[model samples]
Target: MVWRSILLLSMINLLLLFSSPPLRAEAASTSTVRPEFARKGALTCMKCHDDAAITQILLTPHAVKGDADTPFGQHDCESCHGASPEHVHSRPPEGALRDPPTVRFSGPHPSSLAERNAVCLGCHENGQAIHWTGSKHANNEVACTACHTVHIQKDPVLVRDRQATVCFSCHTEQRAQSFKPSHHPVREGKVICSDCHNPHGTGQDMMLVKDRINDTCYKCHAEKRGPFLFEHAPVREDCTLCHNPHGSTKPALLTLGVPWLCQECHDGGTHAGNPYNASKIFGNTLVAPAPQAMARGCLNCHLQIHGSNNPSAPFFTR
Candidate 1:
């Protein structure tokens, strides 16, 4: 019993010396953290948040880093946000976008959102996000912090699916459309809006990443881009001519196939009634003479059908 008591006393003393809460309090009290321990900041933030998350946010590759090694973080957030001189005493208001009233951080008050943006833009203005000022997202009061959590590591912006979900929250109509039987499978993790648009902002009305709408579609449907020897005027001009790409009851996502699909923009010559001698697409086009052969439809001769590059091919024929 005496030996056990002695061992227990020694263990308690070791725990008190090595794991003392006072040691941590003393370490955090200094204005400038020691250089060796400078890689991490927001010491108070890590009490609830995981250390791995805090470390990852600090290590992000943005031009302006929040890492302790960086001058901004090394000097503490107060360097830019201003010192929270009075925060230690009085509590700040709720949902504060800016630093608490107690803190001397720069105020978004009495200034336009543009002015608040200019503060951070001083260093980060050269990147792809520079055009975000004129973007629809900016106009909607969707500030930089909505989709981004600087305090949270693994920033949500990097997750493509999550980013799309953020857009869906606002564009619920598109979300409903995606749930339909025929869609680009956006909800299935197959497609995302950012694949075609620049979410930060764009000059295009729809925020397309490219100057032309076709340019955006070509990213995934490169086959549609062709300089064929015999080009279909509508096909060359726009992809939406025969198809409702979003969702369609027609096969291959076509708006309508056979006579209907071709007839919308295509008019028949002076035939008495249905003037064409041959059949229409997909079906027999007419009667291919043999009922059995009608099952194969217009695909018979127009095999190299989409657009043929052959010099001798007439009417884009095989």
Candidate 2:
């Protein structure tokens, strides 16, 4: 009976050895089949990603097949998304999610931030994006896809009317300010955030399109850009000193109403120091109230408040 048991064990071992070789061969064959670029390019991707949002990319400039600089001209979707033969061909285990593409822009399991941005920089590394390497957005790990939507007919960030909405997603404070009584006509679609700012990057502070705040303001307020005989020191230094470019409760986007705003800097002797109050109103005071306390306040006399080209108007009152 012991000899029979030993013989049975030996047969079992031989059966296991014979079965293991096929398993090893199968594993080796699978490993050797590396992921590669799909032969049909966007056609292959369209088989799975046939939704309106994904297919809308065909209408964008990036899909111009005639232009070799474009994605569709190169390897279509694969140019930006990278090769994904494994994702295209393989099936996930039962009840498990399928493997993602090699470089997903937006999803639950996206590629590394650097990897996502690297794909964009590979093509858009020139022009406005030249300084993007050391830019505030890049340093903060802000992805290119954060502001740009590639799989769309028109990228909202690139559109003048809808641009601020894209920027307001991250700049919530600016959105609140934009709704204030006084603003830069941003909501009216007459002005846009990109008019003053360069989201890609800039060598200037606040990522302003121009080198200085005053210069940026001058883009629209060209009349203020003057070589006047009398120049307002604060106006020349920075527009933001007296003005809130985003928005304000005061008229003309002024940081404060008239005398209050002027008093911030001109708080010295004379009427400039006197605070305008209800007590100094026409009926409340025994003495005639100062003109600085009335309608338009400091601007009542100082008509050319920005600057006066008139040689005699030393106080910017032309």
Q: Model 1, clash count? A: 4
Clashing pairs in 1: 81-105, 279-285, 279-286, 280-285
Local accuracy of candidate 1 as per-residue lDDT tens digits, 1-318:
676456445533543453344347646776564432322233332333334433344334431333444433333333333334343334546854433422221335433455445544554556767778768887886655556555444566567666667768778877776665567766555777777778778778678888777777788888878877777777777666766556665566666654456556546551112324444433645643432234433344445545778888755556
TM-score of each: 0.62, 0.84
Clashes of each: 4, 0
Q: What lDDT does candidate 1 reach at residue 317?
A: 52
- Report the CA-based lDDT of candidate 1 relative to the real structure: 0.54
Highest lDDT: which candidate?
2
